[model samples]
Target: MSRRLTLLVSAAALALIGTPAIAATPGAVSADFAQTSVWGGGYQGQYTVTNQSNHAISSWKVEFDLPAGTTVSSSWDATETVSGNHYTFTNKSYNGAVAAGATAAFGFVAGGSALPANCLLNGATCAGVVDTTPPSAPSNLKAGTVTTTGVALSWTGSTDNIGVTGYDVYRGTTKALTITGTSATVTGLAPSTPYTFTVKAHDLAGNQSAASNAITVTTAAGSGSGSTWPLKVAPYVDMGSWPTPVLTDTANASGLQNFTLAFVTGNGCKASWFNAYDPTTGWDRTDIDALRAQGGDVTISFGGEAGTELSGSCTDQTQIQQQYQAIITAYATSRLDFDIEGAAVVDHTSVDRRNAVLAKLQAANPGLQISYTLPVMPDGLTSDGTYIVQSAASHGVNVSLVNVMAMDYGQHDGIDMGVKAQQAAQATHDQLKVIYPSKTDAQLWGMVGVTPMLGVNDDSSTFSLANASSLATYANGKHLGELAFWEVTRDRNACNGSLTNCTNVTQQPYDFSKRFEAFTG
Candidate 1:
């Protein structure tokens, strides 16, 4: 309806909501609390609230007191409110109803020392069957394939009371992932460096086993072009084709591991599942699932230059979050992206709602990764885009990447696209300093991403294949979070003169993708 193949327009990120629990009236509940990992003046911990009575508990609440200096920074599965040294956690809608003798587990990241005490549930002291015994330490902890910036891990499971809900994989003292399975792939590691890792098992009642046998592994040395973040190229196949993307048309088939499935959107203002590129059918999972089966993954992109953004599709915040959640649940990817532009960028009300929903989503799903893609000038983000970034940080949204669209800057001719892109990235890194003063320059760079339109951009400026190579080198040298292009389908030399579809220049196919793919971060 707007431009780019009648696609519509824009999208954004998320926030959270929760009602406070009534005065503590501990009814029929048992609660367990434990601290799992600690580092950088912060600690990771969990609280398990179980329905202990003979009947099911439809709703529950847990209140506890932290050590004098500690405070909850971010939490999941429950709406947490801190008052002085006391913290109150109420079950979210999804986890409120527990079956008789069932347990719902939730975890949090807290600042200061973690020493939580005086736990109560439903206004009553939560003293469950005291299981003071911790589970057996995880055994056979081993490293799988070691890459330039990551490693795959696996270990024998630990037995526990009420079953082992999850395992904590620690890189040094940092809790990398609270994985539900025995195996996990930990990313964002230094290349060509040796690191020690350990694992611990935890159960429904706040009990954690001793650490697993530590294993040290050296990451394979990376070449000049390398990154610790997940490397992804975009617009894999088109929606019209549905699943069988023409892979050979662009990048080489070997060593490609990730993609951002492009442009899933709500139908106009409906927020129903529809591919904006096609708009006639639901998501085509055939190709996506196949990629996953081959150990590759896709981060679904909602909102391109077109479509009704889910944030504006519904008036009610709950309904809007539900709409976004549907697609997330269906796809079940750990990562997601929102390409915010056009009306979505300036829609203040929707932006606020979206931010709240994202915070809630992050709290509900720890380890969920998010990225925001926005239009930018050669310098930096516009005020609106900066607001989006600030809002995400303020709402406690864990945005792993902030990708800037580094093309089409007012049709300025005779500009070096690579330099413009690099400047834009640097500007973004600078802007992030205000939001994350605690992060070093290098850390901020790692959180920044750049997405350039390959070949002839909409502004009719050419981004040569050489530009692509240089930009990839810059991104790798800076260790940026990601490097992407507008469309993988257009990574070819066949130009119909329409920058909307294919490259503008004549050259070898998949050249741009190959160059960008060299950046593994």
Candidate 2:
């Protein structure tokens, strides 16, 4: 390849990617082409997808026409369905569920000048389906229960030609909330002030309907929390491994009532305990019931280092949501943890889907807490782990805590394991401050959780009993959200050096757990 050609490719790619496609019809799904690279014979290109509808879409397929002799060699992040020069790229299972007002994209390497014609997204024109009619106005708008700073409202939905996307709830002329549901709570109001609200329907092409029936309501005289998540001091227990974790016995010994059970992975769109025990059938109900009987509870973890997460198998958003909802209902637990380590942390499609699903779960079940236990280093979370948290925040998931698996730094060179865990927590707190700028210093610290591998790490360093004590003291001083280790069973056995059956150091059973049990915010 010519150096000049490389330079040309870079410039052309930048210019082409920067060019925007004018949407002829607003609020409609559209796909825009971008040339990412160039060569003498062919080039690499990409298409950015936009979902302008007020409601989310579960899947999308983009098809376009290329001139004779122009062909696609390969594609990624989307499944390709092609015949000759007509190329159709459909969303993969993980990336298919694009939220309302969200975007998805795919890329490909091709054999020509890098532009395509007759672009269509799910059989509609690339510019978006051109429909000019406005939706019917929402009917029977009425106020519901009022709080000190907010008031709830609901109304009958509207209809449209191209399909009604969502509704805009207006607080006297100013748009208060844009929501897909007919009901919503308008917050941030004076306690005793009366306000009038109306709603209007909107279509896919950005057409707004007439104002709905108005209603006035005065907020009550006291404050109440809105969509809150709980803080927990739960430690992890590997339920999938042998011995299967006698929860009550561990709880009895460690005096740690809260447990984060490991891994409820997918059994083909269904929830399974590491693909062995079906969670819905209450396979482990006896242990959970006994644990709960002792005034303790468990947080069902959804993903781990092994097998596939639900989104990897359940392509339908509704089915996946049901799968998760069933587990929550079955366990009757308020907390959920997503252990995203290994390759799952960097998988953006599943990350986004998980965040979206958790957001909905939180909405449906208020005070439902969610956390991500991610891979970390002494310095901080890797770039991929940071992106995982960023995606959750962007998707409106209420993150109760971000637990860093502070283990397995591959170098042996005289590292202070305790100091490394503290540094990682501090660094993660700082990153979170950037992601959530409005949160206070105290709030950011409260969102931190540090989990170091006990006994001997899988690397050159070791986490001794003293290190656990030091980390717990540090966590308590900062009011960190949680303190946990890799597995509860390992803390019981006496063994040496990086074995799952035992902590690599000499210690009595429950020594590590007892140290971390006192951690509280």
Candidate 3:
């Protein structure tokens, strides 16, 4: 939680305990602003708009002008439009009405040096509006027997000063689904997976209630006739401003259903604020928050091609474990991916320690999915890469996926990048079967993942659009676990000599994403 939110929440609780209400004249409307989190170049801001009139308002809008150079990257609870320094936000269908004395809240993440000023609600100044109340949480959450592919969930309805608009279902910190009804069924679950579920209710005014009691449910075991394949696609999203783009913009423009948030590493050796999120634009939770609001999921990835791994600094077992736990708590995503490269992969001690910490997290977080992104060759995984998977199994770590970077095969020598990627996936699949001897070939393939750098890779090898199509077709036919590309930031038609950032080739915007999206079923 951010410090600003803590203070606001505390104030709200006190107001409920008979503290005199902040006085506002009847028939006047007002707005309250709060800064949730801030970092180097940007901040996450929230606004609460209240109606003090005796009658209800059919709809409302808030407008403001951001400081020069600042831009709104993502938003929630309202529809937003930006023109130059001006931004206008209107209520969505379910949150358009504001009852008498009721309030609604919206949040946004922006990039720049400062926040907007002179905010207005419905063309009126927001200087006098004051609301410090939170809605009540829903209760009586129940989970039915989990099926092989889905789970049935329901909960008691919650009341609000205005009206309950919708409910958000979280598998952990990541929202699994959102709906307006009291009951919903979540599908696309892995067989035999144990999951923990929680729910929260929000009103038309945008104030969310406390979380409901968590319920545990395990999906039915596989029928055992054959291996079940779940083919999904996610593109890598950089934490830095590489390729000169923000996460929300890249995500909104992508065709893939999920994203892998890249490279959360130590600022330097033994830095304070371990796992402290500082993206290229700044530290703004609203990026991920807004993505979840749009029904997109994310997997927090640690380590990248560069940077000092936290394990390198926090050598102590306790410190290392705490660092890992901090990330899990912050994102609350059911999935975690480790993109091991350079010394991060070769350090045997760090590898063992990482696997140990991950194993403990898996045991503690039911239904947590763990994936390892390691370097691979045309034939198969290198010795170190093999140790990564082997160490996980040896340490009792239940790894759900072993995704190989199929780009930059070291010695390309003019082989088709797509064909090499397929060969690498098949080789990794074969090795996985040897590691888990009991798993069927289909099951082993289902546990394997492949990521290709779209267009030109670091080694100057090109993965053409036709190559992307070929890989997608192969992935679907073989029922592979997942297919992902190097990044969404570079999924465009033109390149700017950025071998590692942009594809640097002639292609359409999101062409690779569109090609790989075909793998989704």
Candidate 4:
């Protein structure tokens, strides 16, 4: 017997002192045998042995009978001797002990070709003989709606002793995905196609449950068709300067679809501060509801030459992404415009960094519509000279539109000369169409500002409304998108002299009032 047997007997003697002592100690026996842990093709069972006599037992032997189909692979804490399906366990000196009220534990591994039942330990019955193995093979496996690009599948959760971990998703026979919690989004699927999906669950012990019911999904058809382009004309209106009477005008006297609020400033211009957020005052649910009532889209513009918080050095990609996300979430709008003309003052814009910012913003707000206000550069310059326009195309950024600031190039020294700015805007639109054929014509827009000034009367050396009208006519001829003006106040009689000869006026109504019908025609 092991030294532990002696200690158990001594301990038992002290506990049974007050009870009537039996002459002979009952043989130690155990019940409640169970497989605690299991692996592929192997398992371990544990049981407790207790003495039923008033006296201490020094040496104890346990005889266990394995159910059919099972064999004693190994034993521990005792000397095991086997005979057919029955086995005898002689306690080791260190463990051979059972007091009157004391119990001892012993365990062993059993191997079997198939799972066995009716197992017994020391000729006593066991309870809680659970199957620690994984769940049975999942049945009713079938595929649903198969698409060329993507497939969605769902299955029943696997049963297990502890609980099943998440599922492992498969595409065909190959393991394509692993979903821990639940549900997986298999993306990058081809359009107008079919695919199959399968899923299965696993337990903590790496035992996999049966596969779930298979499902399939087909991608929808492409949006573009034929040679006809999906051209959209979205004009930008300054919300800060919109006439309260016109904004509140339900009669639709001034035909406009959307109004944008300038919240940020750039190069000391008349633009508002970029980081200024006042949804309740600057904009609120009331404004959104009103715009919706008028069949208009309400958007906010960031970074103009002289807007607030826009003149600082370029912020890190993370800060920019955070700001965009917060603003979008706060305003509950998916449309965004980056008026990045000031980027020229900073370092040459990093395409990779810009892509990262766009990607981060997209991740935070899926299906976001992003637009860039790019400088209208003349032809024969490095593509980077156009910044956002070329970069977005090269990086595959999902830009909804490119609003070309056709008027601002004159504000810069290089290409500020007359006729050159208009020619630059025209060249930009032509190049963008050729370079990015996949982008819709609606994605290209012409920006026209209405300041109350005209070029030299006969010289045409200066910039004025006549030039803007010429550009608008050109844009219309090309079937390009609409044009945007700066502010209603600047274009009104307040800035321009009267509305009679509003041909080259700054106010949207005055400038476009007479020209609107002809331009749309």
Please tell me which predicted candidate would have the highest TM-score against the true structure: 3
Q: Which stretches of candidate 4 lie over 4 Å from their true place?
A: 1-235, 239-253, 265-276, 279-285, 308-316, 343-346, 349-352, 377-385, 408-422, 433-470, 497-509, 513-521
lDDT of 1 by residue, 1-521 (tens): 11112111222210111111222223335776655555678856666776654545555678888787788888877888878888899987578768767788777878886567777766656664444567889998887555565666778889875456568889999887765567666655667789899999875444789999999989877543332245444434344334446433222453455677666666644453344333221245444444543455567777667665777666676776666665555454556788889988988787777788888886665446678999898889999999998988888787878999998897575678888999999999999998889877776887888988878888778788889899888887888888877766676435666665678787666667778877855
Evaluate residue 457 in candidate 1 and report its C-alpha lDDT on the 0 to 100 scale. Answer: 81
Q: Which 10 consecutive positions of candidate 3 have the poorest summed lDDT?
A: 15-24
Superposed on all Cα atoms, model 4 deviates from the true structure by an RMSD in Å of 23.7
Per-residue lDDT of candidate 3, residues 1-521 (tens digit): 53234234466554432232133444556666766656778867777777775545656788988878899998888999988889999987567667878888788888975666777776656655333344578788887424455566767878775456577888878787765666655655677888888999865445678999998888877645223323278778765653434556665676554788777776543322224543322244445555544445567777888766666656676666666665565454557788888888889898898888788877766556778899999788999999989999999887878899998876757779999999999999989988999887777878889999889778778899999999999998887888987888777535666665679778878988888988852
Error of 1 at 240 (Å): 4.9
> What TM-score fits each model?
0.56, 0.57, 0.62, 0.44
Candidate models: Cα lDDT each: 0.69, 0.76, 0.72, 0.48
Better of 1 and 2 by lDDT: 2
> What is the number of backbone collisions in each predicted candidate, taken in the order shown?
20, 1, 6, 38
lDDT of 4 by residue, 268-385 (tens): 3222333333431223434443444344544556655544333233446665555555556444455566666454424344445656677667666544556666555445223553
| Model 2 lDDT on a 0 to 1 scale | 0.76
lDDT of 1: 0.69
Q: Which regions of candidate 2 are displaced past 4 Å?
A: 1-232
Q: List the candidate numbers ranked by TM-score, top first.
A: 3, 2, 1, 4
